[model samples]
Target: MAETGLIQSRYRLIELIGRGGMGEVWRALDESLGRQVAVKRLKPVGPQHDRTFTRVLRERFRREARVAASLQHRGVTVVHDFGEDEGVPYLVMELLDGQNLSQLLEENEQHPLPVEHVVDIAEQVADALGYTHRQGIVHRDLKPANIMRLTDGTVKICDFGIARLGHDIGMSSRLTTTGLAMGTPHYMSPEQISGKEVDHRSDLYSLGCVLYEIATGAPPFDQEDAWAVLVGHRDTPPEPLRTHRAELPGFFDRVVLDLLAKAPDERPADAGDLRRRIVLGRTGEQPALGPGPLARPATGLPPAPRAKALPAWTRSMTAGRPATGSTPPPAGRPDPAAGLTGQWTAATATAPRTGSSVPAGPPAPDLLATLEGRHGAGIDLGRLGRWAEAAEVHREVAAERLRLLGPDHPDTLATRYEVAYTLGRLGRWAEALEIYQDVARARAAVLGADHPDTFVARYEAGISLGRLGRDTEALEVYRSLVEDRTRTAGEADPETLRARHGLGVSLGRLGRWEEALAEAREVCALREHTLGPDHPDTVISRREVAAGLGWLGRWREALVAYRQVAEARTRTLGPGHPQTLAAREDEAHCLERLAQA
Candidate 1:
């Protein structure tokens, strides 16, 4: 067994992050680079298990490493290193900084996610699956716990332990007959449940189950009996999403239902096709009714096939609890630091000595770990929207970090950044603005003027200025930020486009409607090209264009823009969502103005 602390003379395992039937994941440091990484160590099977089972488990671990390392996409986890240490296999990966959907659902007390969030996740997961499917990989086990959403809003699909390459039919066949089902019962597809041939469409069906659960707080089949759940996947039709959550967008409901089609051919043709459907739906450009099986009434599903004995592999399967089944840690318990950056190590806790450029002695590792744990707790509070408590905790941690590691230390600055963020969330814009400026300057000096962290702080400062109605100051901040972002990240980069969008908003606030309209148009076109027309950012830019046109008294043109925004928002975010209603209000106001004109 791999114990805590240094392994392979390079990685120092610090704390356990997660564990499952297969193995345990640890937060560890790469002693070579002084950076943190996650190490997933395969658990050893006892002699009670057949030798073949042990061999298959090791093979799966190696396969996960190979498949994950081969993938290169923003929506997939990045594998850093993999090897065996003392007969124990471990895979090192970039430590993600946010919760998985299962954790997010648990954090929300099992309530359904916001309509917009559900749509966003669906689109992102579809895009990722499209990329993987094109590479001839099928993730046989796509579950909520196997995906992650980072703190920065990037969604990544994780774990390919059970994934299969399309070209490797021989190995796939052997693996399938190992007397174990390859997928979680709750999310398994009909073909997967029946032990039949599976393909990329199976992944789409699994994604449908995930979306259903997050959209309705329960999977399509929520029965406690494993056999019954498999039976439902194999035979029963799922209830429509809106029947459980009335506010789910109609387009979203249709897309998800189509994915849940009983036969593989009845579902969307491929992941690419699925992505296009989501885009079309979000843009309000989809057909009034989808094609093929999607056009059929939900009740028109063919009757269940005649009952037959289920595959023998299913007999050993357990009615596994949903990934979201675990409750949050009790109020006083130490929260698990699963999504933390893992940067608070002794190597990083150096302070500058008085009147010297030489670094001071490193602080105690135990103290650093404790503070890091507290910092994670603060982040969890923020995730729960307890900004007041989060602010207090971050402030305390920032002070301690500053005293121990110096003002410009990354850990100290990180805590301070959270403090500023929570302050902004609490509507203390002035205080937030002050702290953001401080952090920006510090990060620029310590990291670099063009560092991403520095840019983030500067961007937040502009947001603070805008919230305080300092349009001129906000405009200047965004103009400079746009220039820097364009130079560093390129004009087509999302961050650059985001900065330009902010500039356009500031111009409109300053009554420069013509300039605002031009900026918004440019940003909208770039965003559509780079992020697709249905992306939330692109839609926001489109709305900005409408706002600018209205401010310039071009009510006729504004009405067209407003109506498009309203329809898109309605299709993607549901008709009753606050953003959708606001868009509708804008459309109504535009009609009134056009009539007056």
Candidate 2:
């Protein structure tokens, strides 16, 4: 529940403007500054809720404030202040006089926006993205609803809730532990759909989706089913824009299509390049073509990168219904305008009522929503490193889901998967191994042997085997997983290289020094090429190369590798960071070994 008046004794809430699942936005008067502002207040989590979930939510709210407040661009929404009122977090921002693109579409009856308006919005967004990317920020969740058009035609990008700072890999990884892709299904890049590392290029792909929708009155993939939409993004080449709207400029169509390339490398090199191309196209100059749809022979463009499997988590995702003025709310629901900004309605009516009896059949939708929230709370606890508490909550959720959804249900198996991961974190290797194997089998049966989720479980099973000192078994698991990953995701894919790295480690554990060295070198080179030389995964592979060199009695070469890892870690993670210190320790040991020789 939100209060109606003054908060923090400084800002006065005047009227409710927007509401979302997590918070509500109010048109407020900043008494101290004598100005009007939009104040977004987080919905308070009751004491009955998991304390860990409540804490994580507060942290995320604070992060969004910090990230948004740090930016000072005209094409981005400006943050004024942030504070907590009565234990509820709130953020204050500049209020715009016009609606977001989603609302504009709804107002226009879902017709395509004017072509010139579309081009103007694209250029403004590209310029903003260029600034943000240069500042090392990647907006992971970019959609039409998150971009706004002011009354004066100024365009701004909003919502930094899931944005990732380039230097904060550990924080980013922890925040995403809830097993959900951060972006909307229609806008997700192929790499994002397949659970691969995403960079700024992912934002470009999402912008392409936004541009396509505004230009053609629908998303590039307009499928009703969420799975179908995700598959379309992963495998299908979008129909040319001219196919839907004949009046769209050829150069503009080519630009949007190029941004939608399946491979990040095939897209423009950066937002700066994208902006330049847009500028060139607007001025009647031809932009240089790359390997995108525009570079094709005009007969057809190459198909999207074909992955043999999609992540299983996508199966449970919903196709986010686009907002439309024609569709009225059902009886007893609030007006759509009440929930304008977040593009999602509150879950109040969807959760099971307290003190109510559940029927003894299939679980009710309300009960399922409750279970899902609790499951997410469990994940949040794990993200905070409370493994014992996380394990307890996950076990409880897994049992409930199993009873209601059956052993083969994806939800039940997903909960069970979390339970196993927590057990491994708690050092219960044998128990974790058993659960991992079971989940892998169940997922394989349901989602096929080649599904990414099944492969994820199998990969963890290998880690558990290794932790239990069953090196031979771990080696076998990694070898099979590497082959499958290579066949499905391609050899250069990050996941495939990860499996190969595991195989190399297992070989070293079995004292196969020569084979481990070769495998390590190859995987290290590939990781460097695919993930960048200083990425954490590439650094890990480089460390493995050093370990292989040392095991092969190449002390001088090992020393060089160890020193390189140490220097890279120091540069990226800072000299005082634990990982950098560990790298330094490795270098010292290498020197000691060389001295003894």
Candidate 3:
């Protein structure tokens, strides 16, 4: 350790900053750039003659360098350089002058954060996390020690990609079983503890744990031993954030608790949604949250990177490969949303954004978003039912846009709604429901309940709920959505037409076949008027009308309507497409019912 003064004839090591299982951090200088840097000198491994340790450690170090160097975000600490300085592996990063969350907690034990402050920090971390998760990377080890609160009040995440590399290379042997293989028990996700194939949701759970601690200065699941903590994570729910800070908004508690859901299916669909809710809670007229000062963006910090602009592994901690079973199988190898794409959105310039003439020029710094909000525009090659690819792409773009542009900004929430619709088609109903709910809340928060986007997300949410088998619940949601859409989307708009169909399905599920038939006929008539009788959606809606008529015991009318749908679909989409085949099947069934009648 004595010989670790400086390296590269630059980055002069001034003093030891901190130490962890892997190594010690040193305040250093970048002689080339005349900037301050933090260098982590990893603890060395076994005997040089031990080829096994040496070979493994070297590979791990290289992978870490690649991962850290690749990560460039305002919330993430920047890795300037990494090299073997005289046989000791060293990684140089931006020197953030700040105290860690651990230190802050130690100073103020059990003292709850101001609601606004807790939300601000959570929003920033969620944004960075969303980006990292999308890159297919999970922190695997998120805790207070890894998060630093900069002098200017900004939170900077550190040692992101290094935990895996550092643990594998040599740190595990030194720290014992309590260190490398398992994470800080208080923050470990259940899947991570069980060593199951984890996903981005695992990271969200871990982050929720972190937020739990920050909100109340106590770990969500506290037990005497690491094993107990693991069990608590698997079984227990954290005390609601409001319990600790009763002044906290009820919505904030719901958001945090949702993140801590035992199953990922129950959590908010992604980190982007988390951020949106935070924004609304903090800034809304009747803020679901409290009075926290809005964050200033021009502070000294690097700009966020454009989301979906990085290499795959940048967010691939959970990706494991180009495929995740979370969504249906995609079409090709390079999926845009393959990684931790929807973890957090990149922060746009968040300065007082009320005036119609928005601020121009380069965006302000110190914002916590990872994506720069540049959405990709390109045509994908056709693939056989590659619904996953389209769904993922729309989800990624929509999440980023919402975070970058806000709910009513036209692009962000709008794009997200498209992704939800795609998820329904791709069979990811649970996730789609979550996404649609988020969009709905954001729309209701920003634009009021009657806004078009509000109805859009609510309508989609009702559709997802219907597919998920909570039909009675779906009926209520769809009924409200149908009314809302009729008023906002108008009877002829495609979305309104779609919701009308949802209403009929919900009614059938509730055994109100007469009402179902009437609504279906109305939607079909409206669609036919607006889209021409032969249009695909119109023909599909018409088929639904026939199905409703059959349910209502009007078999002869059902057969007639079904025949028209089958012919129209067979003409436009040929005989093999799913919709076309479905229409034909419906027509045949209706004919049989008619003969019986």
TM-scores of all models?
0.50, 0.52, 0.45
What are the lDDT figures for the candidates, one per model?
Answer: 0.73, 0.73, 0.59
Worst lDDT window (10 residues) for model 2? 314-323
How far in Å is the alpha carbon of 153 misplaced in model 3? Answer: 1.8
> Per-residue CA lDDT of candidate 1, range 1-597, in tens?
447767889999999999765589999999999999999997655454344334546777898999999999999999999998877899999999999999999999999989888988999999999999989899988888888988988899999987878876522221121112356778987666555567888899999999999999999999864545765676567899999999998989988988887666668888777878888888887855466533542432132221112332221111111011122333432222321233423333353446532236666668878999999999888766456677789999998888777776666888998888777655566888999999999877766677777778888888778667687999999999999988877999777787887787677667687998999899889988988877777776777677677667787787677667657766887764544544554554454354446
lDDT of 3 by residue, 266-357 (tens): 56667776777777767752324332212212323211111111111011111111111122222321222322232111222333256523
| Predicted structure 1: lDDT | 0.73
Clashes of 3: 25
Candidates arranged by TM-score, highest first: 2, 1, 3
Query: How close is each model in CA RMSD to the real structure?
Result: 28.7, 26.8, 24.7
Clashes of 2: 0
